[model samples]
Structure formats: C-alpha cells, structure tokens
Target: MVAMAKKISKTVLSRTDHLLEVRDFVSEAARQFGFSEEDVANIVLAVDEACTNIIKHAYQYAPDKEINIAIVRNNGTFEVKIKDNGKNFNPDALKRPDLQRNLTHHRRGGLGVYLMRKLMDKVEYNFEAGHSNEVSLVKYLSKKQSLIKK
Candidate 1:
C-alpha cells in the first residue's frame, strides 16, 4: 500500500495566551509523525515562536486577529505552515541577529527566525502585501529514524 500524506489545521486568536495551545497542538502532531522527543520539543518551540511573531509583529498585538497553523506529514518529512492576514513583513530583509551584541546589551527579543532556522530543516516565507503571510517550518526524519520505522 502507498503511504499518503496527512494534514491537520487549527485557527487561534492572535494572542500570547494562545501560544500554549499552539505548542500543544504542534507537539502532539509532531510526536504522531514519529519525531523523537527532542525533535518534538524543537518543533513545538519553533511553532510557538512563529505564532508569537504573528501575534506581535503581523497582528501588532491585536488579539482579535486570526492565526492559522497547519501540520503536514508526508513520507519522512513533517511541516508546519503558519498563516496570518495581517501586516506582511519579509523575513529575508531582516539581518540575522547579532548574538554577541545582543548578549552584551542583554537584549531579549529578535531571534525568532534564527532560532527557527536552527531548529528546523527548512524555513520558507510566502506573502502577498495586504493579503496574507505564511511561514513554513519543515523537518525531515533522520536516516536512522526512517530505517527504524520499516
């Protein structure tokens, strides 16, 4: 039998309070997709950061705005796609965070993209100004993990 891709989606208000729910939802899906405990944690954190960015940057702290999170499991890859219909910002335009300077200045924010890149195999962005913004976080199962599955 051929394996088929699986997808699940959830919509939540653009509020920090909803982050826990997003994390829980992503973690559960990642675990079911056969990720290791550590990978599951990484996925959860990445999803949380993505949602938090939408709440803070895109939605501008407007709690009533909507944030959509969708999880897709296909073959040995898992992807989380977050979408928002708010102000669009291009991730490529922002320079990478200066870790050393940030540490010296005791800065607390501005590392979401960097952290997401570190945690996931791929980070991609799609946006149409005044319409919607979407960020996809993808991770692939290790060769060992895939071999163990069969």
Candidate 2:
C-alpha cells in the first residue's frame, strides 16, 4: 500500500511579519502527516528559516514581494517547497559556519542554511535565474515514528 501525495500551499508577502503565519501553516500540515511533535517542530523551524532567507536575501526585505510555500506529503516523507521570484542565490555556495569563530565574534546571522540542514533530512535548491528560486526541505518518518503513529 503506497501513500498518495497530499499537497497544500499558501502565499504571503515577503516580510518578517508573515513568518508566524508560515510557521503555523507548516506545523499543522506536518502534524496531519503523522509527524511527532518534535519532528513537527523541526519541520516548522526549517520552513521558517527557508522563508526568512527568501525574504532577506532573495527579496532583499522588499515587503511587497510574493513568497509561496507548498508542502507535499507522501510515503512517510514530508517535503516543503518555498518559491520566490526575487533574486537568485546558490545554496551550494554557502560554506559551513565556523561555530567557534562566530561565537567568539558575537556574530548574529549567516547560520540559517546550516540550521535548516541540521533540522531537515534533506535540503535542496533549484534556481531559474530571474524567474524562480525554490528550496525544498524534506523529512522522512523513521520506522519508530511510523509504528508509533500506527
């Protein structure tokens, strides 16, 4: 028995004020997909970080820009896709943060991508230059989680 994919999407303006809505949207979907509270929290946080990056880097904090967040759940895997038409960026170009150095210098930002990777099972990016930039964050249900949910 294979699980069919279920998808839900929401569009919001590119602004810090909209992040809470994004988090709520993601949290509910993840919960319905049978994720534990801890896993749902991780998914929500990862999705939030992705949206924040889109608003700050891709849209340059332009509040009028549009951000689309879409979630797809299938076969015990949950994936969130965040799309934007602002500037393009290469996630691969980001270097791993030096934790000790950042802590020593009292740095604040530059850790979102790293944190997203840590929270989700997979993090991937698709760039369409001047058209669309999409980041996909994926998490898979462990056997233990699946059994518990059943």
lDDT of each: 0.88, 0.89
Query: TM-score for model 2?
Result: 0.90
lDDT of 1: 0.88
| Per-residue accuracy of model 1 over 10-44 as CA lDDT, tens digit each | 99999999999999898888877778899999989
At residue 133, candidate 1 shows an lDDT of 97
Per-model tally of clashing residue pairs: 0, 0
| CA shift of 4, model 1, Å | 8.6
lDDT of 2 by residue, 46-100 (tens): 9989999998899899899999998988878899999999899887788888889
Cα shift from native, residue 35, model 2 (Å): 1.0
Candidate 2 error regions (>4 Å): 1-5, 103-106
Candidate 1 weakest lDDT stretch, 10 residues: 1-10
Question: In candidate 1, which residue pairs get closer than 3 Å at backbone N, Cα or C atoms, i.e. clash?
Answer: none
Cα lDDT of model 2 overall? 0.89
